[model samples]
Target: MPRTVSELMTPHPTVVEVTDTLHAVAQTMATQDVGSLVVAEGGAVVGIVTDRDLVVRGLAEGIGLDAPVGQLASEELVTVGPDDDLAEVVRLMREKAVRRVPVVEGDQAVGILSLGDLAQALDPDSALADISAAAPDE
Candidate 1:
């Protein structure tokens, strides 16, 4: 059977408080080489902020890095539970064009799942086999 979200998720994903400065969040992302950060309040996930959000929403709007991350965070967060199937997670990602999704438990973010992680877990070799099998015989 394919692995579930809990099997593939990165536990204890790096987080940023809503009150944190954008510059600080950016620094955290840069240091960790992650594309998104879960925004938490009172240990509960309230929103999400991404590198794209920083560039498109902040820089494009002339908002300084010193501005609070909450100003640019997306409050309508789409999340997955740890027990959710990986296939469902992948489907959601494709449908939303989002690269990262928080894995929540009772509204608290316990992990994160990224496209790269899914790709690694699913393995492209299976797709290659399917494609080759469908090709016409020589």
Candidate 2:
């Protein structure tokens, strides 16, 4: 059987509502040790927000913590499904320059497929997977 996204994706990835405040979002990020989150509204993923977004768009712009995360999120979303082909997923990531994509099924965010996930799944013994698992010096 071919490896599907569901086979490799991180299910129930950390999520935050669009109404969530930046302060709350930052706390979630820190607690989960994740760099990004799927931005949801009405139980549907509407966008994505990264730790970089919090710094560049929220803090640097003088946006208060009370401000909604939606304001800083990228409403333009790129998503995939659990059943989709892994090759297509890789292509999308390469073409779109996106590191992560929320796996959605009928407007519901089911899981997340990340480049690291792809690397580990596709070539566990390869150097790319090693690089993907590496962390920068603190």
Best by TM-score: 2
Give the alpha-carbon lDDT of every model: 0.85, 0.89
Clashing pairs in 1: none
Query: What digit string (tens of lDDT, one per residue) describes model 2 on residues 1-138?
Result: 346889889999877899999999999988888888999999888999999999998899999999999999886799999999888888988998998999999989999988888887778888879977888445
- Runs in model 1 deviating more than 4 A are 125-138
RMSD of each: 7.7, 2.3
Tell me the tens digit of each residue's lDDT in model 1 across 1-138.
466899988999887888899999999988887778999887789889999999999999999989999899886788999999888788998998887899999988999987767765576456544543353444
Q: Between which residue pairs do clashes occur in model 2? A: none
User: How well does each candidate superpose onto the true structure, as a TM-score?
Assistant: 0.83, 0.89
Off by over 4 Å in 2: 125-128, 134-138
